[model samples]
Target: MSSFSSLFTRRKNKNRGRTSEKEIYDQEGIPKHYDRKLDRNLCSIQELFKQTTDYEEIHIKVGDLKGCVCYLGTTLNKSELNMQVLEPLREAFKQPETDAHRDLDYLREAFFPAVSYEYAETLHQLVWQMLNGYAVVMIDEHSKALALNIGGTDKRSISEPSTQTIIRGPKEGFIEDINTNIGLIRKKIKSPRLVFEDFRVGSDSNTKLSIGYMKGIVNEDILSEVKLRINKINASGILDTGNVEEFITDETFTFFPLIYNSERPDSISGNILEGKIAILLDGSPFVLIVPSVFTDFFQSTEDYYQPFFMTSFIRIIRYVSFMITLTFPSLYVAITTYHHELMPTPLLINIQSQREGVPFPAVIEILMMELTFEVLREAGVRMPRAVGQTLSIVGALVIGQAAVEAGLVSNVLVVIVAFSAIASFVSPIYNFSIAARLIRFILIIMAASLGLYGILLSLIVMVIHLVSLRTFGIPYLTPVAPFKLKDQSDVFVRVPIWGDRYRPSYLMTKAPVKNKDSSRPSSPDQNTGGKKEND
Candidate 1:
């Protein structure tokens, strides 16, 4: 901690002297709105989208209004578009009253009263609408084109989350469809204060995304920072939430995932309720939760569902496992190579016997096993589910046994490596486990070089790196580093539901109190005497 003071001070001072982008770019702008020419609009649509097989347009003449209904054929509901929209418009246009009113407003009021639509004023917007499954209603000489919400984009049914599964919790998970994901969240947290601001990211892809949060509960500063970062992104295309996450994260070089993401809608809703913001993107199941701290990754949404004691115990195990996964291999290398006196005589003898015929050093043995396990893990993930799980388990056991019999690795080292792999999986978030994996190699290298001292130094440096990082200006360590007593209830250990009444203080949330604090509840008979005396 004392070693990096001057470096920290210099970095902090450097950061303070930096100028904000807001001062440079004084104003923001939007895309160019096209002129109100029907033929030109149709020509532009044709020139831009005609190359695609899904591009579709139908010329519509309603009295004097000569316009076209354009949309992607792949996403359009042909039956509904014709029967509900086109038929009504054609019949309404044939009416005598249609001759008097040649306006889109009248056209809308008379025919589109039952449908949802958007006015596309630019070719970009029109293209976007069509791509997203809207049928644009363009007038002959009107710049504003009404886009009907008749998009029939195929979406998969919501299924159980592949990861983050709990023994007891909601089975429904988010799907690729953004609207459905939002609906799943809305189902959990039905509140007017739940506001979502939509943005179109990726200049070429124009990917639809929304940042959702409780209006008054969320910290406005962090919300603003989120918006500012997202608005600043100039990526050509974003295929997944991971892409957007990279662009908006506070730190670029950090191994830890600064943002927490999940496929479970309940988890996202739970985060939002606690004053954290959720970034939902179209065409992606994973929703990114912002203002994430280090502890956030260690936790599972399942913690809230179970009894507090059990949950607390599980959390403690996770924390312990996290430490073990990070340092056990390094410790083995450090102890066996340099500090042989530290190991028990019997255990040392057993290990020595196991390593008698092994060709590689302790560090090499650990690295070989780790790499083999990683290969198996990757292969299992890439392969089909049925084969993947079987392959990972059987392959690890078979290979470990084979290597042991072949005098390649010590039996004890195999156990350590296997246990380490298992511990890494205990983390609820996949990327969080990855951080430990990456850091383990660094620790191993250090341990091999300088034994226990190197291991300690490596750990201290890792801690410093974690503490130095921030998530939307919130310290990565949060309550742990600063030490917030109230927030601690739910950090390392979760207390009874009523006992922990406050949200995490580090968020600087507008609504800090989760609910009005109440006394711990008891059975009716147990509280009867107290109630009688009070009455």
Candidate 2:
């Protein structure tokens, strides 16, 4: 409860400065400022929400003042509305007050000391607050309205992150609620240097979003670029970070994701401290990290929580899996079609025998199998959880066996396609894996047309495309293509935590050195190095 209070108290401060629609200007429709008359202000607010079925206006009194509280019916917590707002007003009404003592200031200081609130100076601000579950108090002849945050405590409980799960790490994942998400981050990184700037996006949805970064560590150029892109968003609505990603991303023509997103708070916080910007949307559990690189997608937050050598090995395996998933089917097709001499005599004979009864060519066989695998994958995702896994497994087995037996596809082709599909799942970040998945079809086509030569050309083109890509002016292939010897510590191989003493050089962080204590951990016995216990 105390945590929630502090969260909101800080949130209120963050939201106070931001009333803009993308920081350009507030949404047009309502009056710019509040009118002196109470009924006039109430009427303006009411008309804006007249179409809203949940909008409610309640009449109330405080001392000699009469006013109304306007809010959405289902948004507020009833208990808090009574105790923090209504009860205070009623208690204050019991005491006598002179004209100067009965103003908004009087009500704020004496009654609502502990409450999270702010002054809504304009009718636009008032309506915006009401929509966000704030109960606004408008006194007779007072132009200023007091907006109290009586928003409900209802939100999905934090559970293990389903998308990016790990055996060892914090089990708590980010929830849909933005406050809860920020609180989770705040808990992990308790530093005043971690700053969050708020923005109200979507002219219709008015969805809130915040970009959080370590103030001193973050690059000024990168931070400016992030804010610029976010402010330039002209969308009608932004339901999730996915929508925001499309708008702010540098390039959309490529299959690769320009930004990284995660459901874990630790991942976002860790990135923030590392001089990367974390963009969190109001209703999304996944937070987007700016300036994502090719290597960043291969990384898992759990990697840091485990042994460094094991993580490095796992990352190497992921890279191998990426190559296998991307080219295994193509390689099989190329070998069988034109590069048959590359295979040993026995293996070639076996493949030739397998292909003897098959009607379709190797290319057709693999494409058909790949398409079927994709259809089954989609079904598994869209179906009920209880049956989804069963259906996918059963469907794949039945289809593969039937195809091989009926000579629709060779047995080798089935093995190749299935192995490729399994390898595709090895990537830590799902969206990053999709690049290889999408490019695989093109590679298969190349392999079919010109065999091994076409496959090599296709791979060269893919590399050039990746090297050319940029996210927020940062190279997509950081530390590898540009070749920074220092930043390579955490790329394909994660050195011990103490060895990785600097942020990624590509980010151009304000403070490059991350480790205040750069010394590697040593045994107590090693510190005493052949000396007596007293020494």
Candidate 3:
């Protein structure tokens, strides 16, 4: 019995590092005698891992001379590893086979053959890998650890964008996936000159941002400036591109959007062809187009899809709608209150009759009705869809009818408010509609304070603000401010496709001349049917 005990103790000592038997027995060996006391605490890999409940599939294998323990959470790509290493080893142990050739390399080749891996020794890399959804493999007596890619799928499918809808253009919209978004853009613009530059922002989040442009066509200085501004963003989190845009925008307080946001890949591709830089965020459907001039707001994707004559007429109407939305009510108020001499006698008489028996002054009545309409608009948006429609119809009918009977607001003021609301809705972009609403209130206040003089003052201030504003260093009111006649063909009225031979000068495009004069089609009458005087 003493010989058998001695042999077992020798084997145990051989398995561990050399240490004095006295120290081993006293400090490390199992306790021989105790007074009904609990076993002394011992350090182990299992105890270390048991502290965390996150890793449920961690596997530990004990062998004769060496051992291995890996968190099952790490080796995800190695389905074969789970099968070959775990299953085979379990079966081997179940049977009584002592095949002593289970080394680290042997196990690796058997399970994960030809698989590439990187060693991560530092805690920083290990934690980063784990957070990025990698599996970590540890081997006994080796400080280096293996990291395997095993990220889970959690991406949303691409769908049409809620905003920036087009009637005649492509129905596809940018998705949350960065790679898919890039592919969409690439699919539209097949040119090799199209360049996509990637940038990593958000110090903690490391969100990926991509800047796309045509290589030679895009202005180098402008691209440099854009890249510089993007790199300057020092936020902790960037959930969407708006975060980066807000951080880098020249005027944060201004109501106007300096950068144009669009979801249509074709629009972005068109902007790129025009030498503009497009910024795409990882998780946002909207891509930001820089150097957006005032004319861009008036332009729509349908303009290119339809006949130029029809597009030009629509463009003119949009411009007219913009003016009507902004100043129609204020102008009405100003003329009625202070500039009645400008109005014809018949119209003046009609307005006077409409305001008769109204207890409130014209300005007061306008203010009251405008405020009520704005409140209703907000309520319609905040309430549920079914309730929202009911509220909008009921609210408009009840308030409008009640106001007429109560004499708090004139029927004329109500008409003006309703017309202005409808006009504001004509704006193609929702964000621009918001700006229109705000500016309408400003114009109303100006008209009330100083009549026509106040209206003129507001117009001058607005024009100056617009003139001073720059979208990515390009003047907001371009071609108009710079007085470029060539680009004017597509400005107020979109010219026929044949007549649109030049690109906008503000973009500084390399090929401003779209096609040569020789490419112009000659009429058959002029070519062959002319000069029959000899007969």
Candidate 4:
């Protein structure tokens, strides 16, 4: 594979004419901010883009001067470009007496009806503008170019979120376009304090990423930390928020994702309101939320939408499932292989009966089943959608049953692995679920080696690792590790919205108390003295 830097350099230097070959780019390979002679500028740009098939350029006469419009054909909106930008300018310059050199500002002020346009003075800015689906107008003898936002709306329509689906909540999810994702958040939060700061990463791709936070609600220190880490990213290409997440994450060796990502817009909006910062990357539907804690992965948007008590109960079930997924196989291995007395009398007999005639020991049997289930899970994900469900069902039933009947593995081990797999699915974040899956294997090996003692040791190490991890300066096991009593209302069990009015104490938001009203609502009789409406 070609390095992005070399590929970009080759493209930039492909078709240059030997005229005035001064070094245009600085040490960092960014074009210098100086106005080249018009002919030289045009020639340099064309040479930079030479052999590019999708680039479209239009040369037009402007009184005594020459000018041209350039844009990428694949991304630019043709109809909007012509009707909004081209036609008006063409008509304005049609008058024979119009002087292009002097009337440039007049044309800009009087003629162009574009919704938004910006001036780019250097090749650096102009190239970035054109790459972002803007039409660049270069005029002769002019030091600057006009970049018109003449529509780049080619994107997937807003649809129900596929990844983080909820039974009752807003069905809207983020699309690939960064602007649309930001607009979704703005629609939810109509406050003027909502801020989106843009940053460009990737020297070759120049992928646009935006950090969004409520000006008053977000923690300034955390926001600054996030920006500092993002600005420190030096890469050739960033294709998705995952790329940015990896670059800015606090911990890389750990299995747990330091940054949380979600496809649902409502979830992101809720997090923003709670003083969390969101990072939106272009060309990816998933948006990342920072300062993510352990509980954030277990909590869902539906938790807020449903009754608090029921959601709380479900949240407890998720925590239980998390425990089961992580340790069920390990416990089974430890107990059956080393400490058989830990099992009850009947259960031990049943497990021993099932293991009779099994070809491998308990640990080997469990590993075989776990690895087979993992393969099935991966196949279910990668296979074509038409057969994915069928594949999962058949693999679980047919393959597992065959292995048990063949005495390759015990039926009890199969049940343990299958139950563990189901429990792993309870996590809302797929990345978090993957962490559980990974730790499950390590735990199985430890249990096999040192039995329950090894399992306990691994658990202690995991706790230490979790406590040591931080997401943008916030504790990974927050609200639980540091023991922030005020923030517990929404951590393990979410309290009623009225009962919990303050944002998380960790963020240290400017306005900590979002709701200063009474925690309890007054009954109708208490407010009205039991009087009828007619009275």
Which candidate leads in TM-score? Answer: 2
lDDT per residue, candidate 1, 296-402, as tens digits?
Answer: 98888889999999999999999999999999999999999999999899999999999999989999999999999999999999999989999999999999999
Q: Number of clashing residue pairs in every model?
A: 1, 1, 1, 0
Query: In candidate 4, what are the lDDT values of residues 205-321, reduced to their tens digit?
Result: 678889999997777767766777777777879999989988888879999888889999889999999889999999999999988888889999889888899989999999999
Worst 10 residues of 4 by lDDT: 1-10
Decoy 1 TM-score against native: 0.90
Task: For model 1, name the residue pairs that clash.
Answer: 118-147
lDDT of each: 0.84, 0.85, 0.70, 0.83
Looking at model 1, residue 433 earns an lDDT score of 94
Ordered by lDDT, highest first, the candidates read 2, 1, 4, 3
Q: How far is candidate 1 from the true structure (C-alpha RMSD, Å)?
A: 5.3
Q: What is candidate 4's local distance difference test score?
A: 0.83
Better of 1 and 2 by lDDT: 2
| Model 2, span 1-535: residue lDDT tens | 2321231111222222333532333444667768888888877777777788988877887656788877787888878888888888887777777775457887788888988898888776777677788988888878689999876657899998988867898999998999999999999999999999998778677799999999888878677767767776777789999999998888899998999999999889888888999999999999999978888889989999999989999999999999999999999989999988999999999989989998888899899999999999999989999999999999999999998889899988889999999999999899888888889999999999999999999999989999988777767898899899988899988999988889988777778999978888655676678565897
Q: Which window of 10 residues has the lowest lDDT sum in candidate 1?
A: 18-27
lDDT (Cα) of model 2: 0.85
User: Model 3 TM-score?
Assistant: 0.75
**TM-score per candidate:** 0.90, 0.93, 0.75, 0.91
- Give residue 244's lDDT in candidate 3 (0 to 100): 79
Residue 163's lDDT within candidate 1 is 77
